[model samples]
Target: MAKTFEVNKTIKEINERIKNGKAVVVNAEEMVEIVRSKGKVEAAKEIDVVTTGTFSPMCSSGMLFNIGQEPPTMKTSQVWLNNVPCYAGIAAADAYIGATEPAEDDPLNKVYPGRFAYGGGHVIEDLIAGKTVRLKAKAYGTDCYPRKEIEKDITLKDLPNAVMLNPRNCYQNYNCAVNMTSRTIYTYMGPLKANQRNANFATAGQLSPLFNDPYLKTIGLGTRIFLAGSKGYVIGAGTQHVKNPARNERGIPLGGSGTLMIKGDLEGMDPRYFRGLSFQGYGCTASVGIGIPIPILNEEMAWYTGVSDADIQMPVKDYGYDYPNGIGRALAHVTFEELKSGEITVNGKVIPTVPLTSHVISLEIADKLKSWIQKGDFLLTEPVEEIEST
Candidate 1:
């Protein structure tokens, strides 16, 4: 039998608990240390909230803009900015460029594995900073709209339509992509040494979303989050969402679970937190930073947030592209704590691990988000809809 803890206390009670110092609040990293020292039961009894976070390379990230509404407005077709093509078939002056879309001169790993030196994300960054971005487009000149082509340097300040929308982001959990071939493989996780010489893990250790809400109890629509150094929200479910994966007794999903459709203003984003990366032989992507806070609605939520790195696990998924001669297998399971130590055993061979994103930076974002909550600048809100699985 388990103790029944209710999170639906009156709003006054929650406020009083905060004022009287009855609630416990800690970042995900700190909560892990505390839980390890005192155990989950004691940690749940004392902790009120935990802030978890990570820097994700969400290639789906991009921006939609309505360029200048010059006279003879025709649908913005054949659009390019800073040498990268933007999808402009939607309407006149409206266009979108995916974060990983490469420059025209170097397409599809032609010039580089990812051609990440510059791309759509860079164009957005420059626009937000008021730096001029070269824009070119060709349109059919019609009687009502007679603009054939428009070429000029424009800033986002003058753009009529501007929205930063990502269809999939902040994956609740994800696979640790592994390469098994003899040849070295370059991917979003950097280059994978051959013969399983190295492993790469993303997700910030201890401070990750799924670990904080292993059961998807608190994260849902309208949940405020830190996205690329700016405030963003989970609008709905993300792409490829799947639920009900195998799990241990703790009930943490064994595979990637709920995802998020997030939105935010690019103007306030930090450039360092939003980066474009490439692999020697792979395509490019945007490394987007994200952070979410889990409210201790019940003792269960507290227990979930206190889960340690040793308990957080991920399966090594074989991409198989790197190892054509070798048969791909499910591989082995490894813990975040084990992954953080820089090496893990795979097929009886010890290999080094590299993190695609910066843990140091991830923790910093969590701390900043927590401070905002404490200072009354940020507020926690319940999701309009709860996310159950994929």
Candidate 2:
């Protein structure tokens, strides 16, 4: 189908409207109805920005910290913060810690469904919450860096450089997991009941960032976003980012697809938006809240932002068998509307479904981003380079 009219604008023009308090900004949820009622062309002309959000467990998250040089400036060969091992291969005092890195003594899955209460994710939360963590390091005792070992307590304020860099986040769509065997399964998607008694899935549905864009048209490198309650930027396409995943008729990806690499300073970060998650049998992860504002550049963008939960679909896979065996085939496909309704039918059997992501927080993030732009506190930036997508 062809559009009756074309509405076009630019980020500069949108920012000008924001400065003059004339830019109409709405969230993805509100834009859906507006586009349905006002039509795509008119909505594109009326709305200047559409904010999308997602708050879910992201395991590919970590932090880089410059803990400052020791008394004699020792070159760190091993680093541990709060008993969790850290990667010290960066610089003299700089180290990176991934969210999923477990503590050395943590009995992970050894007793079956271990309780991973503390890990790199918890350390990150503590730092952002203004709590101190024990920092320990060891050196090989070089001529210049004479210090062999050191121990100290450090907070986010104590570090000269603290940045949160997530490699893969904001998945476009994800799997709906189920267990087909007699035994229960604990996965990153949460727990699944046996015999397909229940299903678990993650994602913010229509309010998700990539779902709103459907393509990398508006979001790109250097695009500003509300990341974990701090101002952050999209660095590039994230790891395992499937640029051109299989899409349905509405151009929405069917399963795990487009992702973003994001970075932000740790200063002034709110702990509420950045939390440490301990998945029963799984190790640990971080729940990240991200909001991206899409500029209404054309009618196509407005139409894309109009996607609803009913328009989005995800594949269901058996976590006990297919997922564990590295199978990519989906047993069934269901829409977000059905998943959100708390139940879905699979193979003539009705099973309950639960969402692993928070839809309420997602809406709050969108609202917060919208308020920032409406108040002229947040401004959009043109991407330095477009993310490669076919």
Candidate 3:
């Protein structure tokens, strides 16, 4: 007769023995049976691996001893296995598993707005007598793209304020002019047009207006102007209305030529700004012209061109240079003694006629006038205000 043992008592004794030994050893046959049974139980408990079983403790008892006999399969095997918490099991059972999803308020998705970061060498320093600086022109983003080709009868007011190109004549002949209005030097595309109604005439589609009308006020003096395919020039005067247009030979029109017209303080052109392809082109050209050997763009150069807030102090005395009405006349007539004797130095410098810096121009007026000006075709008329003298 087969040995009859109490099931609960046998299991309890075996468990006690194993615990005392700190390890369990069974006869080869019994060991195989144990391993096979253990595997089935583990596989069933593993939600991802076992799909055809219900792992109830009662069902597990029959499976534990019937290792060799045909194993019984659970009725709701597929359903129960599929519903098991696999993710939770992995996280609880494995030490290596990590949280996969990111937090809802992650800063990685945030975006920053675009801005111009001015650095060292962005201004025109002293224009040594014979040194040459290459100026390259490139368009950034959709807002800066030059849409229209060169057009005839287009005046400075009719061009896109941001879309600037070298004047055909100016680049060809290297002749430049001082923009009296901005206090920056500008190289003329050619000789001033004798019969042209506007003093400054951009080749049919080559001209662009100042970036902003109000900002034009702060350009101040000693600015530089660079003509693409030519050398950089200094600003003798800022932007001004001339009686005639600067002229050059009517060479090929500069439209679609991918050239640039640069207007700023040459000192602002620190080597840092020349990092990419556009800057490299300018650096190459500048090297060819002036022999000032330097990389197209470097971090050191960028740091040099950036201006600090502390550097921008207001002048004590007002020179009528920035005013539209009598400032010009007032600027011209200030006696040397009066200027010298004044408490501040603002009244001493002669103000050239130029468009105000974009920052200084009124936004309302600029918005209304920009479209017409950028087209380089619209004529602007200032409304006269009737005033009663007090």
Candidate 4:
């Protein structure tokens, strides 16, 4: 189709509209219907921003803390928060706790399907929820700092600083996992029933942040966002970020691709949007809520935001054999629409499907972000540096 007109809008212009209380903002789900009926060109002329969200168990999530130094300070060489180990090599009192780090004495699959009740993720939740967390640290005695080892119970309020820094979150696309073997398998994607009796998948599909801006055109370094129920910012492309993954004709990736690293203050975060999750035999992780706003720069942005669940095709792989053996081939392709219907066909047999992420909460997050923009509480930000798209 030949273009009849050119649509253009800038971040500064959008902010002006937002400041004037005239910007038209819509959630990703609503954008789908608008583009379906009005077309991209018309939608771009009318809409100023499209909001997207995802609430999922991102294993790469964690928190960074700066515990106050003692009167006679000592460099912390070892640290544990609520029995979960944390990395203490950053500074004298700085430590990083990974969400998936298990407790030192966790039964962990020593018995089949072990209950991973507590870990770093749980400790983070407790701190944010105003519950006391036990902290233990060991330090070498020195002339300037002589304290050896100390233990104390601390709350979020007592910490000098607590920051949530996720290395990777909001995957563009991911696998639908199934077990082809007779025995069940436990994985980060969740447990797969034997003989493909059940299929498990993640991602909010069309509502995911990366999907609405597949090329990272509008989302990049220093872009403000809603992270775990608080205002946050995108630091840059996440770890293992794919530069240019293979995609279908519509610019939607055909496999797991693009990711974003984000950071936010852990203080004043809402507990409802963050939860500690246990994947049985697998381990513990965090269910993080993220919302990103996509400004409609042109018709292309409008079109991308309108992608539907039926239009997205993700790979289906066997966790029992394919994923574990490092085989990168897909068993079959399935759409999110089919997955959301609660069943999908795999290996020529019909099986039940379950989502590992919450679509309902994702929509709520998008709507909440929209309200923030409408109320002029949140304004669009121009990225300091555009994310490289190869």
Candidate 5:
């Protein structure tokens, strides 16, 4: 029961509904059930919009800081925030600290697995929470940029624009990983029990951005989004974005695809939504929360948003050692419904599934966003330019 519809005309229709405050908006998590039980045609007709959300530890996250000159006006060549290195390579007073950067003294995983106690992510968290961070930097003496070294305690309050401009955060589809090794390994995916004992997957199932719009039609430049509680936009295709990844029958990526580079004011973001996470055998990362709304521009867009969990598919990979390079012994073939059921059958064995991403929090985010759009506070946007697939 599908019909032809144009994106422009559909946007106008949705905008009119928004004006009257009667647009049918639903969280993507709920849309799946509605589509399955009520059929796509009926379900699409009822819901004019869908919002997707995700909260995960993204290693590709970091902060841009502008360390001020304290009379000395030092040129910061070497810098460390809370004993974690900040790339002073940006400018005299600016630096960026990646989430996974380790302490200079213990750069190696000598601590066995990884060091989670502190790193750039923790530093970013502390700064965002209004805590003071220790700063140490050394620079060669210059007449214009006179001072060569600086040591002091600085707070993000000193530099109000300590922004979060991540090159990457969310992924279209992620793998369900299990360890085949004898010993447990703590990783970004969380602790994977030895010998395929457990499977851990991230992403908010059907509520993920790229999964909801596999073609990147609605999500593009200038698209308003929910970022750590504050509003932001999709700046461009994120780093390492494999836009043309192979897709399954459902038009969902079999592995990871489309990524988004997002920008937002750190001062405006809620501290609760941005947290630092550490894995025992792994390192530290920033758990970023994000949400995006898709407008039902037509039955096609509505149908896309109404895609159920049972239709999405992601591969299961071995994480015992060589990850990403590990064999995808079996495809989960299960829907987001089965994936979230807390258990899934793999290799004919029913294995319990653990989500590194929080579905409960994600749902709450979606609901909060739906309320925003429903009240005329939030608006849908068509991307100014499509992300190039390379």
Candidate 6:
């Protein structure tokens, strides 16, 4: 019959044996490893018998015991057999140390520079206080698309047809300006000036405040203005100057009476304005001049189209057009030096060593770095400890 044992009694016996540095062994399962030497009759110390086993009754029973290697210290609470090393206690201590110690190289510890955004625009009008002055104007063109989308996959063949077709499309041109002093909306109209033949069409130099008129503000001195509206067409930013062709009524030169009146439209034009008329079109047209010739300005208008003031403000800068020139120039210099040293990379490739400028690093890259810092990723570590020379 098989013998039965009480579980509690067996556990108690085992614990008692462990306290006394004794262990019980059951039936031997199998042999592990063995080594033999040629000579017999020699001293056991010189006999050289090697064996692999979990535990050995004597040092000579295991090859590792006679290998002339010092045994690792085994603490009372630690356990090992023969000359083999056990790492359970050491690993447990290491885990405890790791849990209590702070990291030295966490990536979430860096500080980043501060940044901001700003924007502004202007509205031309003819009324002052509450007087209705005769406001005569003609809107000649409109645009309602972003330049990037317009330029993408575009060919010369698409140019003519892609031009905004509706000359009277209010969707193409309308903007709002805030009187910084009054904090009121100043509505303005856009569309290149179309009818120079209309006697009421004033000279380009004429100053006309759009909403509060009769306050003739000089038009040509590069006065900064702020225009704002829902369609992402706020302005008086980027470039702020209007040009005039020297011509009198009937499109004739003033002194030379017989000079032929130019019957053709001016090469570059200003969008026309209409009073008390709210027209429908893409908010894009409202934010940009329909006839601005400079492609950069046009591109700016298109890029900002359909963007909201709140959305725009959410970016690093409230107004991209308002970047500080000096800071930008300095950053460009630093970036250039870094590129020369192969410190910065783009598209997984090193940028060629060239003149450095803020433009070179790109606003996207700068913004990304700022974002990483904000999220506690790229951080500076504590200074490393120095080793003493022997």
lDDT of 4 at 317: 92
Tell me how far the alpha carbon of residue 57 in candidate 3 is from the true structure, in angstroms, after superposition: 86
Clashing pairs in 4: none
- Off by more than 4 A, model 1: 1-3, 6-24, 36-46, 107-116, 321-329
- What TM-score does each of the candidates earn? 0.89, 0.97, 0.15, 0.97, 0.89, 0.12
lDDT of 6 by residue, 129-235 (tens): 12222211111212421121100121212112111111111111111111112221111211111211000101111000110011111111122111110011111
In the range 112-179, model 3's lDDT, one tens digit per residue, is 11111111111111111213322111112133322212112222122122111112111111111122
What candidate 2 gets wrong by more than 4 Å, as runs, is 1-5, 107-114
Q: Extract clashing residue pairs from model 2.
A: none
TM-score of predicted structure 3: 0.15
Cα-based lDDT at residue 38, candidate 2: 94
Residues 164-278 of candidate 1: C-alpha lDDT, one tens digit per residue:
7888887665667667778777766667777788888778757877678877777888888888788888888788777677786777666667677888877677776777665
Per-residue lDDT value at 326 in model 1: 55
Give the better candidate number (3 or 4) by TM-score.
Answer: 4
- Residue by residue across 152-255, what tens digits does model 2's lDDT show? 98888889999999999998889999999999888888888889999999999999999988888888999999988989999999999997788998899888
Across 1-390, the per-residue lDDT of candidate 5 in tens digits comes to 854554334666776788789898899978877777876667666888898888887889888878877776777888898888989888888988888886666544555546556677777778778889888889996887889888888887777357788898788887788777899877778889877778888888778877788888778888889988888888899988986888877678878788999887777677777887777767778788899998766556666776767778878777876685655554455566777888888878777888888877788788888999899888787788888653
What is the Cα-based TM-score of model 2?
0.97
Lowest summed lDDT over 10 consecutive residues: which window, candidate 2? 106-115
Candidate models: Cα lDDT each = 0.74, 0.91, 0.19, 0.91, 0.79, 0.17
